[model samples]
Target: GENVGLHLPTLSVQEGDNSIINCAYSNSASDYFIWYKQESGKGPQFIIDIRSNMDKRQGQRVTVLLNKTVKHLSLQIAATQPGDSAVYFCAEKDNTDKLIFGTGTRLQVFP
Candidate 1:
């Protein structure tokens, strides 16, 4: 499926600042959630994940939050760095156990 937006949203942040990337998922029954970071010429790498039973989960400098009520998911990157500059995607597994990914959001960390 497609993301909620028509165009890929971009989140610009300072090198040491925090970055928040948001995604609105379509399935209310989605039980699993994941946040992925994809650099140029590479596949998406796992950043963090949150289960439907939990509201939040943290990994390294990244955090994933899930709001089942609104079917919204968000990824927070603390102390963003130049290496954090990339396309981030949010995915969720619905009742069918199929993973559906969002359009993606580009995170640009500036000096």
Candidate 2:
């Protein structure tokens, strides 16, 4: 089975600052990668994604970067807000279309 894991368990950031979360995947064959934000007692929500072919992709205030060579992935959030506080996870989709989720990083945004 494929495995995805986070480099850090928690990250704390001040409001209006930037936040970065890191992840690592075991499946090098994975073609697609996705970053998700999960609020307390809620399901994960899609934030951004980057395919293996691309190095980076950006959304409204979020960015996803993939490094196939090192099997590393990262998510960058701009202007962190209280609402942005959540558990962030990175998921990888393999050739079989199976999605493997990481342990998740808890993002704590403080005023």
Model 1: what TM-score? Answer: 0.91
**Location of the lowest summed lDDT over 10 successive residues in candidate 1:** 1-10
| Residue-by-residue lDDT tens digits, candidate 2, 40-87 | 666788888888999999899998989999999999999999999888
Error of 1 at 65 (Å): 1.0
Off by over 4 Å in 1: 1-7
The lDDT leader among the candidates is 2
RMSD of each: 3.7, 4.6
Candidate 1's residue-wise lDDT over 1-111, tens digit each?
323223668888999999999999998888999988888777888888888999998889988888899999999999999999888989999778778999899888899
Candidate 2 has an lDDT of 0.88
